[model samples]
Structures are given as C-alpha cells and as structure tokens.
Target: MSLRDTFRRDQVFAPLRPGTRPVRPGQLDTGGKHILYMEDITVSFDGFKALNDLTLYIKPGELRCIIGPNGAGKSTLMDVITGKTRPDTGSCFFGQTMDLTRMTETEIATAGIGRKFQKPTVFPEHTALENLELAMAGPKGTWQALLQPVTGQQYDWMAQTLETVGLLAQKDQLAGALSHGQKQWLEIAMVLMQKPRLLLVDEPIAGMTRQEVERTAELLQSLAGEHSVMVVEHDMEFIRSIANTVTVLHQGSVLAEGKMQDVQNDPKVIEVYLGETG
Candidate 1:
C-alpha cells in the first residue's frame, strides 16, 4: 500500500486526534464565479474505494443538494472537499486560487468554508449571543484571541446574525433552552457570522417539525445570493423544496446530476434508493 493509502486507512479506522489552534475564516468572497471545483478525487479505505474519480463543481451563490444510498461515499466526499481527508490522487480547488488538496483543514476553513454536522453543536451553557461571540473569536491560543475584547464591528456582525436567524430577541436565552429547530438555526447562524463563502450542511431537517422544515428551507434559500451552499440530506421532500440542482452519489461516484426532478426520475438513482428503501 502507498503512504497516502495508509494515511486514509488510519483516518478511517483510528481514533481521530482533536484539532489544535483554530484558524481564520477563509475569504467569503467566491470571486463571483466558480467557488469550488474538484476533479478525479479518489479515496480508498482498507482496500475499499470510498470515492472513485469524483468530479463536482459549485458555482457562486448556488444551493446544491447531494443524496445517495448508504455506503455511497457521501460523507467521505465531504471530508475530501473540506480537507478532513486527503484524496489518494486528485485535484481540488477553491475559487480560482487556492488548491484545496494542499491545504490543511484549518487552512481550508480559514479560507472561508464552514461545515455543520447533523447535530447542533452550540455551546449549550452559553447564551445565544455569547455563542456567536465565541464563534467570532480569532485563532485559538493566540495572544490577541485572549487579550482582545469584542470589537464594535464584531458586535455589530453578531447582532445582525442573530436578527438574520430570527433570534435577535432571544439573544440572552440559553442555547439548551431553545427547541430543536431553534438550536439548529442558532448553529447555522454561528457559521454565518463567520461569513463563509461556502457552507456545507448535513441532514439539516432530520428531526425538525414540518413548520421548522419549511422555515429552514426559506432560510437556506435566502442565503443563496451571498453564500454558496452544498447540502447533504436524506429527506427527499426537503431536497425538492430547496435544491436548484441535485447530484446523486452511489458507490463513491456521481450516479446522476441535474435538476431535482430529472435526477429523481433517473433509472440509476431510482434503482439504488428505491430498490433499497422499497
């Protein structure tokens, strides 16, 4: 096995060591064009190919959804894009400049990519406002991060973010006190405050109420012009509501890509998701 393959196996099977020292948010500007482009990304785990020559792209201000059956390598693909996992051989680029395959996760995030896992990971003990405050904190372990007070601009950004997420009135409320939907919104808001250029959201409406799902759809739609969003979701209804374009993954490669309606009707996508779920 090659060294890169060994590293991939370690990352998949070994205990993940915690990351150290936070990095700056990457520039949120997508240069008003193609924000992310990937070509021939491949990752193998213990001799199993998780990603197979996958090529994907996102234009600025686009909201794209990815859906796939289990073991389709959906999560692994996200890991590669976000720099959490390195591809055995491929090229990943952000904007027109930085090469993502060469950057660390911290550097990639600093360059303005933000990811949200399925669960809301807010600072439960902190009030809504305080959580945003901490999200805006500079690189951790730095002198300025410890010595610096929240700047007026940061405060302004926090307040605007709270308002944007419809939590301005609940700024002082404990995060744990919020409902499931509210907590989800708060987490998204936290990332928004960083003003990332690309946001990757995973399973956002997994447990949300119908009303909450509707609102969340609207929220993501509103962010379209200012941020490029890539959503991974299992909820077909949610995808139908929000996706402008949809990409289906199966066995670690693009099974289909097009409008949601077109992809939904695809024989390959239907055969995979329908055969299993049916």
Candidate 2:
C-alpha cells in the first residue's frame, strides 16, 4: 500500500515512540486558557534582582511582545521560561500542570516550548533542507536518521515547513550562503519541525532590512492562533507592527500591559523606553 493511502495526521508521523504525533498545536488539551503561567517569580545575581516578583500569564495561541530597557529583565524572563536559569522563588507552570521549575531544559523542550535567540545557529556546510531534516530527527540520533531512508511524509512535511518560512527557493543552497535574514528564517523553520506549542523569540529583527523585517512580522503574526508566540524586542516600530498586546517591563516587573498604542502613549514608557513623548 502507498504511504499516503495509510497516512494519518493525528497519529505519529514517525515511529520514534508511543504517543508521538506530528506537531499540531492546539491538538492536545492545554486544560486552561494559559499555555504559560507564572506568579511572583524572582531571580537575583549578587544582590541585584533580574526578575522581581513578576507575574505573567499567556493564553493558548496568543502572540505577546515584551519590551524593556537594559536590566528590565527581558532576556532573564526567557531564561527562566526555557529553564536555562532557575528563579530564586515563585511558581512557573506550562499548561497549568507541568512545573517548569522542576523540569530540565530538555524536558521543557519536550513539553513543547521552543526558544530562538538573537543569533541564528545553523550548520554552515549543510543545505537549508538538510538543516531542517536534522531538526525532524529530534532525539532519534542523526546517525540513525542517516541510516534510515527518509519517509515520503517527512519529505512533504519538510517541504511544507520550508515553504512556510519562505525558503523553498533556497532549499538546496548552503545555509551559510544565505543572507542574515534568511538564516534567521531558516532557524525558525527548524523550530517549527519540532512542532512546539509555545515559541519564544528574542530580538528577531535586530539586523534585518526593512523588507526582511516586514516579512518576519508577517510570518510571526501568521504563527499566532496556531502556536503561542512570545517575543522580546527593543524596536518599538516592529513591536507596533505585529503585537496585538504589549507588556512593558521596568526594573524586572511589569510596568504596563495593553495594546501597542496605549503602551506607547503612556508617560512612563515615554520617559524610559522610547526616550520621548509621542
């Protein structure tokens, strides 16, 4: 029988293990509105507070942006969420049940949260398609994937992801040969292959051209409602371009939470973040 004749979207795309399924966000029950829940979380370094009593909640499939000045704890917040750093105190949960503080970084990733940092990391010698295939291999071991034949479904899925990230034309090109913006998109496509439910992106547009930034905004906005996305950025225009809701952080705590317009108009934001009144 042909593979398509027997393919199942709701079933595991590969036989990696029992209960493994193609990453389809919202397919699994989150059991609550928030995909991430944090309360009174704090972190300190040598008598300095990185995150101070920060309480935050994100609903399933919401695209939220976080902005703050230096030491406002933007990156630190992501570190805590991704389990890279432990908080000094407070509770953090993934989907209302998984205690994030209790899980290792690998475990947190397995639980369906993926993080992308400012720098794009890809195999320089590898083709764009090759980089994505490595991501699909997951814990199965790259050598094992190399030994096993690629399934038709996996090819289709990789192709779809490449198209989604607008890298189809460069599919066979060396990842290193691509432009900076293309590298960033390629990195994001790799993240998608893992089928993460919550995506944490940091400073995604720092070095992109105007066109690249707009395309990225479109891509990130499109991701909302399919996967919950949280972005940490300093570019107010980019934040205004895509974020439906923005959270302003100051001194490791939330200073304001509202639409981009409202936050942009706030006097505190003018004095501290934008550097001028609008």
Candidate 3:
C-alpha cells in the first residue's frame, strides 16, 4: 500500500492510547476550592530575581486579572505555571493533586491549562474550522490529523466552540483574512478545542478596536463560570471593565490584590504602576 493509503487505514484502525487523551475538568481533584496554587514561588537569573517569593491562588471558575509594569515577572509567572520555566524554589499546583512544577509543558497543557499569548498563532492558510480541527485533543501528528476525518460528535463540539467564541459565522473564512481581533478570538477558540479548565490570556486587548475590546470583554466574562480565566494585561481601562479582582505585580512579587477600585486607589500601586501609566 502507498503511504497515503496506509495513513488513511491507520486513521480508522489505529488504537488510541489512553494516556493521550486530554484531562477533563470532571477528572480533576480540586477539593471544591482553588483550581490553582502557587506558594512561595521564586525564580532567579544572573543575580536578578524574576519572581521573588510570590504566592497566588485561583479559585475554580473565577476571572482573575494580573497587572504590572515591565519586568515585574508577569511573563515569568505564566511561564512557571505553563511549565516553561521551573522555579528555583516553591511549589505550583493545579487543583489539589497535580504538582505543576513536576510536569512538562505538554503535560500541563494536556492536563487542562491553556495559554493564549499576545500574538495570535492560528494557521493563516487554513479556515478557522480547520485550525480548531488541527488543535483538537489527540496524539495525532499534523499530517495524520489532516488525513483523519472529524467524527460527527467532534464536528458538533467544534461548531459549538466556534459559537461560544462568536466565530461560527466565520468558520469558513481563512484565518489570514480575518481581522486582528477575529484572529485573536479564533486562537482562543483553538485553545477551547482542548477543553482546558484554566485559561491564561496575555494582553488580550493589545491591538483590538474598541468594539472588539468590548466583545472580547464579554466573551471572557461569559467564560468565567465555566473555566478559570486568568488575564495579564497592561490596559487599565480594559482591566476595570472586566476585573472583579486584580492582582498587581512589582519587583517580581504581588504588590497588591483586591477589587479594581481598591487596587487602583492603593498608594503602593499608584506609586509603582498607575502613576507611571498616568
């Protein structure tokens, strides 16, 4: 048989490994409280502390915002959570059972944590639907995935996910042809295909138009009760629009954390970040 024919047969006949499946929220052991915990986490580089004895907790289904000036270790914090960087000291946990520090990046993602960076990384040449298909939770290689047909159930779920992100109407549109904001939403939809329990978004509104910003805000708000949404943003106004609780980072530690109004009014926050922004 030819290589293409072999792959086509394998698509239907190959047995999937149990371990390759993405972990569902129902499978997580969070003890009905915090979905994530970072205790006394610290990371250092060349005598510089990127993160210094920081502790944070994220409750299940909560929308939390993180704010800070440049070099405040915001990226490093996400890095640690995503398993890109291993902290020199401290513990990071997903739910009550999973130790984040002990997991690999791929392992963490498969375990239900998804991250969307500032730049949209969709497949520009593919339609939005195709992008999600490629991102579906499975162990297939890209080529194998393209050759495999999506099951009816998977297609229905993908459509629902597109609707959730407000991109169902644009499912057939090429990712490269979509607006910047649409592309961002498309990337989010792609992540949703993995059914993550915790979503870490970085600078979601960086280049969005005002209307796109509003829509994005609404989408994020709608997602909170179902998935724990953690946003890291520099736009204070945007933060105020969606944040119920905001955490401020300075010098690689949590400088302040509370309601948006209170955090904004904090003298320490003003002295370090808000004053500079103003």
Candidate 4:
C-alpha cells in the first residue's frame, strides 16, 4: 500500500494495546495556571554569554513558537528550562510551587516538563511499541515495570499517543525500519507516553518532506489545546502553521513578540531573522 493508504487504514483501530490505560485529557498547567516562567535567566560559557538575562513566560495550553538567528541562545533557553544547565543567576519555575532551578533534569521531567530533542532517540533495536513502553512514566524500579506489566489504562494511553503521532500502525515495526520523518514522530510519541503537562519540542520539521511537514504541523496544532508547547524551530513556514504567538530573539534577548505577521513586519526583526532582501 502507498504511504497515504497506510496512514488512512492504520489510523483506524489504533487503540488495541492490551493492559494499557487511557490517559485522561488533563490540564497542561496542572499546577494552577502558570506552566513555565523564567526571570532574568543568564548563562555564559567561559565569558561568552549564551543567554544574557533572558526571560520567558508561557501560559497554560498556549502554543508558542520561538524563532531566532544563529547564536541567539535558543538551545540554551531550552536547556535552562529543562534543568539540564543551571544559569549563573535567575529563577525558573515549573508552576506556582516547584522551583525548576533547584531541581535536577530528572526531577524536572518528573515535575511534568517533557523535552523532545532535535534528534530522534528511539532504540533502533526495539519495536516502536516497546520503545514507548520503556518511556512510560512512574516508578523506575525494575520490579514495577517488568513483573507488573503496564495496566490497561497505560496501554490505552500508549495507543492513543501512537495514533496522535501517526504511528499506530507501525507499532510493531522496528524503529530502525522507519523513515527519518517517521522516526522523529516515534520519538515524539515516546515522550507523549509519559503524559506530560508541558512539552518542549525542538525543530520538529527539520528534515521532513513537504507532506510530512504539513501533517506534523496538524499534529502539533491538535496537541496545543491539551498541552502547553514551547517549540524552538527554524522553519518559518512550519512555525506559521503552529504558532499562535511568535517570539523573535537576537543576542540572547527577545527582540520581537506578537503574531507572525507583526513580527515579520518589524524592520529590526526582518534584519535579524528575515533578511531585508527576503
């Protein structure tokens, strides 16, 4: 069957996993409104400032797109939010209660922050279903996962997640057998398996075909109402499709923030992000 046919047929009956629970649609900002906040976040690498007093705030269930030129500290911002890199001085909050700055990466993830890296990281040897199973959230004790198989609710969650990411039919296929775009979606599905409150996605359409990119845009858009997504991406077209609010960065600070059209029309934003010629 053609890829299109496969997608249509496979999309149906995508929720057949046994012993899995159906993840309830919950508020992305479970901690009472404020999902993420960064104030005066600054980070430097040997005197070269990567993030200079950067501040960002994301509202609950908002799909925010961040665009910037090279060396604008986009990646560093994500790192700070995820607790992978602590800033020299700043405050990061996961909600009204949890202070992200004091937490470790693992702690932050457990606190409802899920990050999808630029590269897909699914285990090549594992089937897509197994890869997602390994990512199920909760106690990491081997006994909890192995001796006690995932409950039906968990399986339902996984199945729904697979369908959401457009990979339900490929669940039995080896991760190694998927195409580049499919692998990217698989990686995203793995993250969804944990049912995070906030999701941070990076360059989701980096190397996808035109059709794949469009479909991916639709998927992300569908997820916005249920998850607060902070996407750092370079593809302006893809950003336009998914962004409800656009932020432009230059020299580690916000240069422009508004609708895509407004930001694009800003002369300074044009000079920094879009060339004057374009």
Candidate 5:
C-alpha cells in the first residue's frame, strides 16, 4: 500500500514559529515547513524485516506521538533516524536539505537532533544545575570540561532552562535525590540547552506519577513553536494528554494516523495493539 493511503503530509505539519537557533551546519531548514521526511524506508536483520517500506513525515514545531506494540519497528525507526542503524532501502531527510540517511550519528546530533531514551540518565553526584553544565559540555575534551567554569551567561541560560523544566526549585539539589519525574525533567532540560531542532523522546511518562505525567505534558506543550518533538510511547492516556497527532504502527507499517480519539477507534489498531491493552 502507498504511504498516503493512511495519512497526509499536509495534516502532519501544523504551523508554529520556530523556537531555537541552529548551532551547527546541516541544521534543519524548516522555515516553518517540514522538519523530518522519510519515504520507503526499510531495514532488515538476517532476513527479518524490522522496518518495511516505512514513510513518515513531521512538521516544524509539532508534537507527534507514536503508539505501537512490540516489534512494530518503533525502536528501529528511531535508530534509523538517529543514525544508529541505517536503512537498507528508502530515504530519510531532515528539512529541505541534509539527507539523513547519509549522515553519521554524531553528525545527526551536531545538526540539531536530540534523543532521550527510556531511562533518565543524570550525573548522580552533581546538582541539577551542574548536571546541565556537564550536558552542555558534549564531546568536549575532559580537561576543558573540568577546567571551564560556567560563565554568568551560561548560568543564566541554564537557569532559564531549569525554570522551563520545572526544576528551578531543585537546581541546587543533587540529581540522584530528585524524584523519578523530576529526574526526567532534569534530563529533558539538559537536551534543550543544546538548542536541538528535533527531539525524539521515548516513553517520557512511563514510570512517572500522575502529577508528574501531567507536568511533563505541560513541559512538552511549552516546548512546541521552538522544537519539534516526537514521542514514542505505549501509554494511551499519556498520549491523549499530549499528542497533537497519533500514529499507530503494526508489523512495521503505519496502520493509522490522526487525532488520538480517531486513531484509538480504528478497528485495525484496536485488534493489533489497543485491544489487548484496554
């Protein structure tokens, strides 16, 4: 089946103003247009099709959620987008320029794509603010990271980020001491400091308390119009809270894509994934 048989590109990208600046070349030239592009992407592991002729698109400043069961190619799709795994066929692009299929993982990150995994990772011994400092020190020489004091401007920048993630009150607290939700926010704050154009987040509220899940939704909502965020999650309730659009995957292909309620009601989705869940 053709990709458009399920969803439309025009619908995927709703317009919003961009929020950050590009720090490096090959950055997305969204111009309030498409931030991500993919078509006919396929990946195989020993004759097992992890992803099969996948085609997807995301718009600038959009918050999109992907819901699918295991083996639906969700993780592999992220791996392909991040340059961790290359597609055996098809193509991927970021913005109007920069072919994503050709760039290295490091180049993908340098070009303003940020990824947050399922588990929150923070510097346990470091304070919330210090943890951000270390995050900002990405790939720098060890000595340089250690010798450099956070400048007043850098601290100011981080302070703003702290407030953004609802960590302003916990800035001086040890990261390890923070609650699970707070740790997730701290990790999110760390990524924002890099001014990424696109953020790929996995199951952000998986282990969060109800309150934290609510707050995380607010945080993600606040990030739109500056950063395009794509969330991969299985929590339907959480997706309902934050998803502007929901895409459902089955057998490495999109089964449905649209509003949360609409996708949830799709018979195909219900049979394959949601039926067993609820």
Candidate 6:
C-alpha cells in the first residue's frame, strides 16, 4: 500500500511525548495562547543587520510556513529560535515563561523544541531502527544509551515512529543504503523520537524528487495538529501544497503574512520576493 493509504487506514500518528524531566513553575505556561513568542528580535553581524525587529508568534499545534529570498534572514531567524544566535535585542519565549534568550541550545532542545536542518544527518553505518535508538531522548549519554538494551515498550514505540514516517519497511536497512528522500525521512524520524512540542524544518524538500516531495508534504501536514511545525522552504509549489498560513520575510523582517492566496497577492511580497520567484 502507499504511504497515504497506510496513514488513512491506521491513523497512527503518535501523541507527542511529554518532557520526562520535572517541570519548573511556569516553565511551559502560555496563558492558553501561543506556544512561541518573538517580539522585536534583532541580530547583527559586523555592520549588517541579519534580523531587525522581527516579531513572530506560533500558536500551539500550528504549522507555519516561512518563505523569503536569499539574505532575507530566514536562516538567521531560525538561528535565533534554536539559540544558535543571540539577538542584540528582543524577548523570545517558548510558551509564556520560558525565556529562550536566557537558555542554551541544549536547554532549548530539551524543553521540547527540535530543529532539522536542510541536510539529512543520520548514522550511515547503523540500521534505521538503531539510529532511532540512539536518538531517543533520555538522561543517558550516547555510549551509555547504546549499551542499554531496548525495552519491549521502547521497541514498540520506535517501530510505531518508523511507521509514522513511512519507514517501517526499511527498519532493518542500513541508513547509508537508503535513498536521499528516505534518508531525510529517517532524520525526521530521529527528531520525532525526541517528542518535541515545536519542530523547525529548514528546506525539507530541497533535493527531493517530485514523488518524494509529495510524500514529504503529506508527512509534514500530518504532523501539524500534534506538534507546532515551522517550515522554511524556497519551493513555492511545495509551500502552496502544505501552507495554511504563510509568512514572507524580507530584509530581516516579516513583509507579509496571512493565507497563502492573500500573501501571494500582497503587493509588497510580489515586489520583494514573489515577482522574482513566483
């Protein structure tokens, strides 16, 4: 059966696993609104401003698409969210009380924020199942985690995750032998293993075949209702296929945002980005 067929038959998308560690007072409190809040964010390099007073908000379980031309601060915006680049000014919060600017990258990830870069990164020497095993979030170090045997429950969860990503059939295959698209799916599966509340995916379909791109769109769409997903992509067609709300970035700030059609029709968006790419 096809991936879409399987998804329809099983409805097998797993619920996001909650953080295993103890929660601090107000750690994830969002006042029942947005899961992410970035207000007046600014970042600069040398003399050039990579991000300037950019404000964005992501509600719980939202799938938001970000599109822009080169040097529009798409990458820098992601860097700020993942704690890779500290902004010169702004208040970034995960939920309501978790101050992202005050946290480390590791801390941010552990707090249920996961990022998947453009390139697929997987353990080539290991089987698909083994890669997920290594990626399972826990207090154990890498070597220590590898040493411990997979429990029956853990194994079942891993199997389910593979199925969710349409990779159950390739579970025993070496990751290196998988196709490029499959490798991308494997990396996504690895991130899913961490059970993040918000997922950041950068250019997910960059080198994918048409068929692969379709599958990727379906995969990302299916993930939305349970985990907030932010996708930064250049392909207008792919974005149109998956986007409900699109945000266009220009010169380090949001130029336009709304339904895809509205954003497409925006005069500013056309002048800055769509005219060239659309």
Give me the candidate number with maximum lDDT: 3
Whole-model Cα lDDT of every candidate shown, in order: 0.81, 0.84, 0.88, 0.79, 0.84, 0.87
> What does candidate 1's lDDT look like per residue over 84-168, in tens digits?
9999987777765567888998888878888888999998888898888777735654344435687788888899998887899
Number of colliding residue pairs in model 5: 1
For residues 159-247, could you state the per-residue lDDT of candidate 2 as single tens digits?
Answer: 99999989999999999999999999999999988889999999998789999999999999998999999999888888889989999
Per-residue error at 217 for model 2, in Å?
0.5
Over 15-92, each residue of candidate 5 has an lDDT whose tens digit, in order, gives 332223342566467754578877788999999998998888898889989989999999999999999999999878
Best of the two (1, 5) by TM-score: 5
Report how far off residue 152 is in candidate 3 (Å). Answer: 1.2
lDDT, candidate 2, residue 221?
Answer: 96
| TM-score for each of the candidates | 0.85, 0.88, 0.90, 0.85, 0.89, 0.90
Least lDDT summed over 10 consecutive residues: which range in candidate 4?
16-25
For residues 68-104, what per-residue lDDT tens digits would candidate 4 score against the true structure?
A: 9889999999999888899998777665546678888
Answer with 1 or 2, whichever has the higher lDDT. 2
lDDT of 4 at 123: 84
Q: Which regions of candidate 5 are displaced past 4 Å?
A: 1-27
The residue pairs found clashing in candidate 3 are none
CA lDDT of 19 in candidate 4?
A: 12
What is the Cα-based TM-score of model 6? 0.90
